[model samples]
Target: MNKISYIRWFNEIGIDDVPLVGGKNASLGEMYQNLTAEGVRVPNGFAVTAEAYCSVLEYNNAWQSLHAALDGLDPDNIRDLQARGEKARAIVYGCQLPDDLQVEILQGYAQLKREYGETISLAVRSSATAEDSPEASFAGQNDTYLNIASDDALLDGYKRCLASNFTDRSIHYKYDNHFDYYKVYISVVVMKMVRSDIGASGVMFSLDTETGFKDVVFINAAHGLGENVVQGTIDPDSFYAHKPSFVMGYRAVLKRRLGSKEKKMIFTNTLNTGNIAVEYTKNIDTSSEERSHYCITDSDVMVLTDYAIKVENHYSNKAGSYKPMDMEWAKDGLDGQLYMVQARPETVSSQKKGNILEIYHLKERSVVLLRGRAVGTKIGAGKARIINDVKHLKDFQPGEVLVADTTTPDWEPVMKIAAAIVTSRGGRTCHAAIVSRELGIPAIVGTENTNEVIKNGQAITISCAEGETGTVYDGLLGFEIQQTDLSQLGHPKTKIMMNLGNPDQAFSFASLPLDGIGLARMEFIINPTPRESPRFSHGEESGKLVLT
Candidate 1:
């Protein structure tokens, strides 16, 4: 594959191949090819091609230079690590652009111009081989230079991108992923950009974060480029859209502010709508307000929705082909276009019948507590010990009981290696319970104070199959699968689920035929650190209080 020509790489792999395609190219291919097939209007753009990147790195013998700079620095020493990363980047930027790769890039840009129009402003971005992952979003890890003014800027932007591999965040991620210094590669894509008078954009997910319900489409739309939404920097307009109904069930925000064309950066005279002509602005940092505008109209929204569904379906189909996917997507509001940004293996277990065999009788409602949530069901038995970070998670030896405030996505890897799972926040619909049940392990959620009551590495027993009343034995008491039909659980129509913090939770719930989730909290979705909630937030915040 390394020896293959750049053009061939673009032809065969395309954007669908996330691992090898590189993120920017994959998104372009997804939007321009697949999503367009379903009739969505994506902003026009062309990928500079990953092969071009490889050719540049290989031809320049740049790997050795970069390697020499970052060769033996301790990955954990963030300060020294950053300084070395900067040094490597300086070397990459200092090198001259190769003639042939430059020519190819220019040709792609020229082709885009012929198609989208010569004056089209473009968004030049870095799509490295190692970025945009299930475990890592690669948020701002690479450079995405928006609103390029001329051809010269585009070329420079590409160089800037190559240099960005050395950015602090990118360096840290590479270290965390254990990517080899010499092996890490990057791709550049110079896309025909969307120029909007009113900039509005944001991210949307197929599942609800507050609840694990798979039926709802959770959206966070803001006035600007959607950066605020991804970074959790702004209180964007939040909505819950029901999938089956395709209707907005709920929407909330403190305020709504759109971007304006009056700013000096206005590059286009086109107006998307009379009412939405202004771009939205939100206070991102203390300095000047961050601005964004939405160009997708109501009709465009419908078109984008259809496109989003197709992109999602494509991902689902791929995952189904191998094993179905749990996915994420974002849209370019400027063009009423949707982009398939991420996809991952679905791990939540199938739900089981509320059979007698699935049920376990509990000794009493003697449970530990942790961080709390608004709602959820309880399972398991023990004095819950709240774990905070990867260090704390690693501290657990085999057979030592574990508990948390709430689970998050990052916690997935560690959960696979834990003795037991307990939380104070999630309900039957939560990620923790779902994954636990799938793993066929004991998990108790909504067990408030599991953190306060249990000490680190304390011995305990747990049972999710246990009835509403369960006993907490200081020693290992039992392991059981308490099951119940959703119909009998009060909401016969809705799927009952527990919230989860990590990917392992999903796998743990793999055996049950759960109608999917009613909620999957993205927060508490990762492994907890020592400082946060003591890993018992669910217990203290949402679980029942038991006085022995």
Candidate 2:
């Protein structure tokens, strides 16, 4: 196909044309043409194009041998997997580029230099067919070379990115996702990498992650590129931006921790902070210096929300549409303009009504001993286990009842499987209460001294929804039936559960019927650093539950 036709094809088909355009080239063409037309500002750059990528792949056919080898290999064998993946990468990188492709790549770089000028360096990023879809979000699954000084570097960077398609993490991700090995083709899109003033850029979701509310756009930004923010290397500032702009609620930034611009990670350093260091751990370039500007402002939010609505409206008009959207947007620091990065139909909209639960805005989950009457309701059947602290959480198996003194934020995994929770001391606002309400699990909390009564892995019962008079039954005591009493008067379908911290309270549910919990609290899923549980003062064993 002619160059213009290939570019046009990419704009129309996106990743669907990896065989013709390659991943990166297709994405660049799509972003440059379609996204730009839609008012998303992607820094100007040129794609060497996927047609070039396929020519190289076909020249070597390294993919065929790699595919055959991968077919028989067990995914559980990490050593063998890593070795094969490395070999595949070596084979791809070793292939010689055809003269025509090489000239095209250099010509593309020249075009970039011509368009964006020589004043700024370009970022050569990889875009593989299997990556960056709304379904998988294979972000950072491929290599991206930044600050390329010249054309030779760009060519070398492209080869390296092709090799990166076989990186251990990349391979594992593809294997787990069951991507078609033969069909997982890649294309490269070389872009004029933005010299961000904020040192780093990060993603903002147009909804609350915890509560799934569409009214708020959650922004997580850090001192450097979004990789650090998403990876949790440093605490990023979180902003709650209200949709369609609100005078006050539109911008609320939470500065958790600031990162050091000068203190970068070095493998040769004598001082070991034990943190995984990336090559970009060099001193912050002046290009990304933090500006005095607020990460987000009310005026900026109004502009972004307006753009978000426009994009949303435009996409809704597309055929085969189902529900509302969840989208990603990026902002150019210099222009201070918002850009639509991606758009996808919201998945939760298709789920059953039971799984459709409202998300909440929470500061954080905490550990607290509480009390409650156990209502006689059990949902899923499971064994029982009494856990005292975070370190012991894994000991409880899936489909087991967890009785704990108090749980911390680390116990999310165990809660996913636990039958129910029964605590000795907390109330409705406690961590146990909040989680139980969210997971649709049955729980009983605030039953004073209840932890002293339950044993680890012993059979027990809990009834969370019976309010104050719920009873616990040793065996499955009643029929499973969905209830709507927990939901508010207007929102009758809303489900509410219980959170608990103690095990002994299981006996409180020896009678009475109740519905399942909305969440199972697991605050201390796993404690990395051991800390003493909050202790009772002298003569405080019988202290009033409401100390405040």
Candidate 3:
């Protein structure tokens, strides 16, 4: 058989091919290769390689033009940067796909049709080289076309994905991350669409996103397309499953939150102004009946939680270490089957030092100004800065609490500088909550009227240390931070094991007078350190020293 250049099937690739297929495709291929036989459902797909993307630009004579447009451009000058980015994208859009690449894509699609059927609708998604990495997640920074049914539309989607590499946000992200524009390349992932329009779709994390708690699987689900949940356009239903207890056949669903999912994105067939047939997503108002019901059932929740645990365990065993994953899942209402669309390494708390638990307590009683789902186990107090738009993000001073109606990826620049975040709309998996947790800042989301109730420049206390309900208090209420030493603690008859996840805290934890560490999350200690390697078999006793 001759070597194929343009496309690589999901079964033919793995995580090692990230340079060729990009992170998203690489992860999909990884799951398909390693977990499909284990009963995990991943939609069949093929990736247009980075080499194909480069060839397309070279064939269209746009490579030189794009580089020249980017030459000496000041990324800090927003207008100039946007203008250059637009010019580059225009060049990509103006060009046509090389005949060979087009033939390859069509051939790949035909193979899928042979397997799935002739009327199989596809999703074309952009997968940049640096996206979905453990260091930085460029989520929702590119384009994705769903329900593409024709050859022309598929080709067009490919071009759009290529052009999306020059989106203003993409350009700014590259500049902000110090990634060389020339080195970053784009790959297109063409996969069988999971018919999420007919059912439900959302995101799931193997570990608790809020507090870096390793014993739970956090899932967020909403009707129709999963983008709404990821983009923070709608609040979704939240589910938390206790992982430790789950293994013992206990359905430990710790909590469930029903969101006001007022809108849904459904795929529809329509004709363009030019009379061309196209498949697009239409935003329809969700009925009161739909809003009041859960998108998924209790059975589905258990299945999803089980899959999360299985995926984590599979990857952990493969890498000879623990691996917490961020995954996207969808249900096919037509067939009542669920599918895993994408999975990647969890970037946030997994990378942080988790030795110390900073417990916060309010020193004085105060009136609660607002309440919502808490995203951390700490307290923050600062002047509240109510920001309604991204244009005035710079006006927000550092150490001020960021109060917003909602937040998108654009608000990240100012969100990092905030001492805390309070949002009027969003769930635990929304952008505001996710970023706040990653930044180690306290956040209270889904307050519904936080922006209206909270005034600008008012001193307020944001407390997420109190269970699931986060509260915003009026004035600068006094608080105390108590750092408990892991080494020195009172002993009891029963074993008191420490939850030592970060390797940096291993030595300190080892000095503790407890029986032993209960869950030393392997991903945290995977990186090489000066000390000996830590190794433990499954189901080990508490007193046994696991660290080598």
Kindly list the per-residue Cα lDDT of model 2 for residues 84-175, writing each as its tens digit: 77787887888887777777777767766777777556666666676544444455567766666566666777888777777755676666
Candidate 3, 185: how far from true, in Å? 1.4
lDDT of 1 by residue, 1-548 (tens): 55443432222444456555576566556556655556655555555555666667777788788778987877555456657878988887777777866776677777777887776767776777765444444445677666665656667778888787777557755666677655656677666565432355555545543224455444445454544444332334434444555434222221122322112223332334642211222232211354243333344344334444455677657546422223334444355455544333334321222332233444444343333221112334444456765445544444445577666433444454455676644343345543454445555555555666767656676643322222245554544445655444343465656554443234234234555533254333332222343233354465642222
Ranking by lDDT: 3, 1, 2
Off by over 4 Å in 2: 1-39, 197-200, 244-296, 319-548
Go through the candidates in order and give the clash count of each.
128, 68, 0
- Residue range 259-347, candidate 3, lDDT tens digits: 89878889878868784443488878899999999999878888899889888998788778778999999998778899999888888
List the pairs of residues colliding in candidate 3: none
Global fold similarity of model 1 (TM-score): 0.56
In order, the Cα lDDT scores of the candidates are 0.51, 0.50, 0.83
Candidate 3: C-alpha lDDT: 0.83
- The order by descending TM-score is 3, 2, 1
Name the lDDT value of residue 281 in candidate 3.
Answer: 87
Q: Candidate 1: misplaced stretches above 4 Å? A: 1-20, 133-136, 247-305, 321-548
